[model samples]
Target chain A: MDTPDTLRYTRSHEWATDPADGVVTVGITDFAQDQLGDVVFVELPKVGTKVKAGQAIAVIESVKTASDIYAPLDGEIVAVNEVLNGEPEAINAGPYEGGWLFRIEPTDPSAWNGLLEASAYEAVAQEG
Target chain B: MQRTPLYERHRDLGARLVDFAGWDMPIQYESGINQEHLAVRQDAGVFDVSHMGELRVRGAEAMAFLRYTTLNDVGRLRVGRGHYSMLPNESGGLVDDLYVYRDADDDFLVVANAGNVDTVLDALTAHAADFAVEIVDESDRWGLLALQGPAAAVRLERVAGMELTSLRKNATRDVDIGGLHVRVARTGYTGEDGFELFTAWDDTPAVWDLLIEDGALPCGLGARDTLRLEAGFPLYGHELTSTTNPLCTPFAWVVKDKPFFGRDAMWGAPCDQRLVGLKVTGRGIPRQGYTVLDADGTSVGMVTSGTLSPLTRESIAMAWIDSSLARDGTDLAVVVRAQAVPATVTTPPFYTP
Candidate 1:
C-alpha cells in the first residue's frame, strides 16, 4: 500500500532503491509484507554470493506459509541485513526502511528499465 | 458462493477472504494471524463459526441409533455433557471428527466440520431410515461464535447474568443472550478455557458487535489454524480424512470402548504410517506435502501440516512417517525447496502451553 515514488518494484513484490552509488538496497514492499503476515524467520543469501535475476534467493517465513524472495536483477550480494537474523519481526515493523533484506551491485544499471515504476507497481498491487 | 452471516463484517474489517470448502470465508483479519493468535491465547478473541454444521438427532431410539453410526458411545454421555468422537467408514478410514452434546434423554447435538455437513447429514439420514430416530440439519438456521482465551469467562459471565464457575469443561447450558435464547457450550479447539455460543441466524450480528466491543478481537481461520496447531490439535483435512485411519492418527482414545460403526475394521488395519510432530532447526518452513527423509536421504514419509509457530517462534510440522521411525528424539529431515532441513521426530503435540 505504501509504494514510494523513488522506488522501483517487480511483479513478485521486491522493491529496489538506487542510491548515488552503484549499489542498490532491496527489500520487499509493504503490500508484500502485509500479504505474508508476521514474519518469524528470514533466509537471506550471504554477502558475496552471486545471484541471477528472477531466481529464488531468500525465503520469508510467516506463521502460515513460507514465500520465496526473488532476485530483482542479476548481481553480486554486497551486504545482508544482520538485524533480521535476530528480529524477524522487523520485516513486519518497517518493510521499506529497517526491514531492508540486502544490497547488491547490479550487473548492469540499465536493467532497471525493465522494472515497474511506483505508479505501475501500485496499479498492479491494487488490481483485485 | 456460500457466505456466512459475518461475510460483510469481515470485508468491512479488511479481512483477506478466500474460498474454504465452497464457503467464502475470512482467513485473517487486519491485525493478522500472529497477533490474532496471541490475542486468543492472552486475551479474548471471537470467531465467526457459522460455517460449521450442527445436526440434531432426537427420538426414542436416538441413543441406539448413534451407537450404530458413530465410533464413540452415546450411552456414556450424560445430560449437560459432551464428548469428542469420530465417524469412520468400513475401510477403517475417518468420515469426520465431531463432538456430541447430550441435551436430554432423547435429544443430542452433533457438531461437524463445515465441508462435511452435507455428507454427514446424508449418511445419518440413510442410517436412520428404518429406525425410530429423526435427523435434522440445523446449520443454516443457527449461527455459532467461539469466544476463546483467559478473559473469555470474564466477558461472557457478565452477558449471561450468571457466575461462570458452574460450567466445567465440555459442559453446556441454555442462556438468554440479548433477549435471544441461545446455547452456550464450555468447550473450544484452542486448548484454552472458552465457550461457544449458538444463537439464531438474525441475532448473530448484534451479538458479535457487542462481544467485539467487550474486548474480543475478531479472528479468522488463519488464527484458528495457528492456535489449534500450537495446541497440538488435529485438523479435519490435514490430520484426518477418509484416506486416513483414526487408529494411526493417534486419536484412538476418541473411539469408544464398545462396538460401533467401523470399529472392527479399524482395530488392526495394519497402519504403516503414524502421525508425528517435527521441529525444524533451519530457517525455512516445512509445509504440507514436503518430502521427509532419513539420514541416508531415503524418503520416509511426507508432511501433512506445517507452519511457523507464533508462540514458540519455531518451524513446527505434523508428518505421517514410517511407524518404525515415529519415535520422539529421532532425527529426520524435510526437503524444503530442494534443501534438506534438519528436524526431530517428536510426539504429536509439539507444544503444551
Candidate 2:
C-alpha cells in the first residue's frame, strides 16, 4: 500500500526509480509484493540483457501463486539485486528500498515520463 | 460467486479473497500463508471451511448405501466415528474423496469437496437405486470450521466447555457452543490434532468470532492447502482426479478389502503410475503439470502439488510417475521454469511429526 511519490509505476504493479543519466532501477511496487503474499523465490533477469517494454523480465513466486514482473520500458539490464536470490523476503520487507530487482538503462532517457506518476499509480492500487 | 457467512469478517481482516470452485473464499490473511501454516503446525489456526459441502444420508439403508458407493467399508465405521473415503467411478477412476461420519446406525453425514458435490451426489444416487436411503444436499444448511494444531484442544475447550481428552481421533460429539447445538468432531484435513465444528449456517460467524477471540489464528484456504500438502495429504483435482486410481496412491489403505461400487474397476484395473513425494535437492520449486524426469533426462512423471515447506523450509512436491521409477532414493529432476532442477523421489507426509 506504500506508494512513494518519488517513483513511477505500471498497471502490472512494477515501480521504476526516477532515471539518472538514462538509468532507472526497477522493482515490484509495495502493493504488488503485498498482493503477492509471502515471497519465496525471485527469478530475476540476467544483467546486460536487452528487454523491450512490457516484456516479462522477472518472475516472483509466492507460496500460493507465481506472477511475472514486466518491463516498465524498453531498456538494457545493467544490474540485478543478487540479494534477492537469498532473501526474497527483502521485497516484502522493503519493496522500494532493499527489494529493488534490476537496473535498466532506458533506450530513451525521457521515456520515463510515459509511465504513471505516484498519484496515478495510487489510483490504480486503490482499484483493488 | 457464492459467499460464506464469514465473508464480511474475512474482508474486514484484510484477507486476500479469491474464487475457489464458484465460492468467494479467502485464500490468505494479512499474515500470509506461511504464518498461518506455522500457526497451525505450532500453536493453533481456525479456518472458515463453510464452503465445504455436506450431504445427509439417512433411512434404513443408509449404511448399506454408503458401503455400496465408497471405497472405504462404511459398515465397519462405528457410530460417532468418521473415516476418509472416496467415491469410485466405474472407469478405474474416482468420483471424489470424502469424509464419512456415522452419526447413527441408520443415519450418516458425508462431507465432500465443494466443487465435486454434485458429482458425488449423482454418483451416490445412481448407485442408490437398490437401497432405501435418502441423500439430501445440506450444504446450505451447515457452516463448517476446522480448528487445528497442537494447541487446538486447549483453545477449543475454553469456549465449547467440553473435556476433549476423551474424544478419540475421528470421533464426533454434539456440544452446545453458545446455545447453538454444534457437532464437534476430532477430525481435520491438516495432519494436526484438531476439531471440525459443524454449526448452523447463519450462526457460524458467531462461532468463528468466539474461536478468534479465544486466540486461534484466523487462517485462509492458502494456509490450509500448504498445511495439507506438507502433511502429504492429497487434494482433489491435484493429486487425485476422475481418472486417478486410488490403488496407486499411498491412500490405498482407505480401500478396504470389501465389496463396493467400482471395486472391479479399481482392484482389477491396470495402474501405470504411482504417486510419490519429491524433495528438491537443487534450487527452484516444483509446480503442477511440470514434467518430472529421471536422472538420464527421460520424462517419467508429472508434479501434482508442490510448495516450499513453511515448517521444513525445503522444497517438496507430490508427483505421479511411472510405477517402476516410484521408489525411495530415486534421483530425478523436475522441469521448473524450463530448467531441469535436481530432485529425489520418496514417500509422502514429507514432514515428520
Candidate 3:
C-alpha cells in the first residue's frame, strides 16, 4: 500500500527506482509481496544476463504458489541479490529496499520514466 | 461458491480467502502460513473445518450396513469411539476416506470431505436398499473446528470450563462450552494431540470467538495442509482417488479382512505401486504430478503432495511409486521444473514433535 512517489512500477507489481547513472534496481512491490503471502524461496537472474522488457527474468516462491517476476525494461543484469537464496523473506519485510532483486543497466535509461508513476500505479493497484 | 459460518469472521481478521471445494475459505491470516503452522505445533491453533461434511446413519442394521459398504470393522468400535475408514467404490479404488464414530447404540456419525459429500452419501445409500438403515445428510447442521497442538488440551479446558482428562485419544464426548453444548472428538488430521469440536451451525461463530479469546491462534487451510502433509496423512483427492486402492498405501491397516464393497477386486489387485514419502536432497519443490525416477532415470511414480515443512524446512513429498522402489533410504529422483532432483525414499510421517 506504500507507493513512494519517487518509484516507478509495472502492472504486475515490479518497482524500479530512478536511473542512477543509467542503472536502476528492480524488485517486486509491497502489494505483490502481500498477495504472495509468505516468501520461502527466490530464484534470481544471473549477472550479465540480457533480458527484454516484459520477459520473465526471475521466479518467486511463496509457500503455496510460484510466480514469475518480469523485467520492467530491456536491460542487461549487472548484479544479483545473492542473499535472497537463504533469506527470501526479505521481500516480505522490505520489498523496496533490501529485497531488491537485481540491478539492470538499461539500453535506454529514459524508459524508466515511461513506466507507470507512483500515482498511476496506485490506481492500478487499487483495481487489483 | 458456498460460504462457511465463519466466512465473515475470517474477513474481519484480514485472512486471505481462497475457493476450496466450492467454499470461500481462508488460506492464511495476517501472521502468514508459517507462523500459524508453528503455532499449532508448539502451542494451540484452531481451524475452521466446517467445510467438511457430516452424515448421520441410524437404524437397527446401521452397523451391518456400514460393515458391508466400507472398509474397517464397524463392530470393533465401541460407543463414543471413532476410527479412520475409507468409503470404497465397486472398483478397486476409494470414494473417500472418512472418520466413523459410533455415537450411540444403532447410531453412527460419518465425517467426509466437502467436495465428496454427495458421492459418499450416494455410495452408502446405494448399499442401503435392503438394510433397515437411514443415512441423513447433516452437513449443514454442524460447524467443525479442530483445536490442535501440545497446549490444545489445556486451552480447550479453559474454554470448556472443565477438565478434558475424560476425553481419551480417538474418543468423543458431549461437553458444555460456556453455555452451549457440542460434541468434542479427540481426533484431528494434524499429527498432534487435538480435539475436533462439532458445534451447532448457528453457534459456530460464538465457538470460534471463545477459542480465539482463549488465546488459540486462528489457523487457515494452508497451515492445515502443511501440518497434515508433515504428518504424512493422505488427502482424499490426492492420495485416495477414484481408482486408488487403500490396500496399497500405508493406511492398508484401515482395510479389515472382512468382506466389503470392492473387496474382491481390491484384494486381488496387484501391489506394484505404493504411497511413500520422499525427501528432496536436491533443490526445488517436487510438486504434484512430478515424475519420480529410479537410479536409472526410469519414470516409476508420481508425486501426490509436496511442500517445504514450515517447522523443519525440509522439502518433503508424498509419492506413489513402484512398490519395489519404495523402501526407505533407497535413492530416487523427482522431476521438478524439468530438472531431475536427487531424492530418497523416506517413510512418512516426515515430521514428529
The clash count of every prediction, one per candidate, is: 0, 0, 0
Candidate 3 wrong stretches, greater than 4 Å: none
Q: What DockQ do you compute for every candidate structure?
A: 0.73, 0.85, 0.77
Model 1, B173-266: lDDT tens per residue? 8887777788889998887889998889888888888788888999999999988887778998898988887778667777776776676778
Over B56-106, each residue of candidate 3 has an lDDT whose tens digit, in order, gives 999999999999987988999999999999998888799999999999889
DockQ of 3: 0.77
Q: What is the TM-score of chain B alone in each candidate?
A: 0.97, 0.98, 0.99
Give the lDDT of residue B352 in candidate 2.
Answer: 55
Q: Residue A64 of model 3: what lDDT?
A: 83
Q: Which portions of model 2 show Cα errors greater than 4 Å?
A: A123-128
Residue pairs with backbone overlap in model 1? none
C-alpha RMSD for every candidate: 1.6, 1.4, 1.3
Cα error, candidate 2, residue B79 (Å): 0.5
In candidate 3, position B89 carries an lDDT of 88
* TM-score evaluated only on chain B, model 2: 0.98
Interface RMSD (Å) of model 1?
A: 1.4
Q: Please write out the lDDT profile of model 1 over residues A1-128, one tens digit for every residue.
A: 89999889999999998744898899999999988888888889989999998999988988777889998999899999999999988998999999999998999977877799999998888883
Higher-TM-score candidate among 1 and 3?
Answer: 3
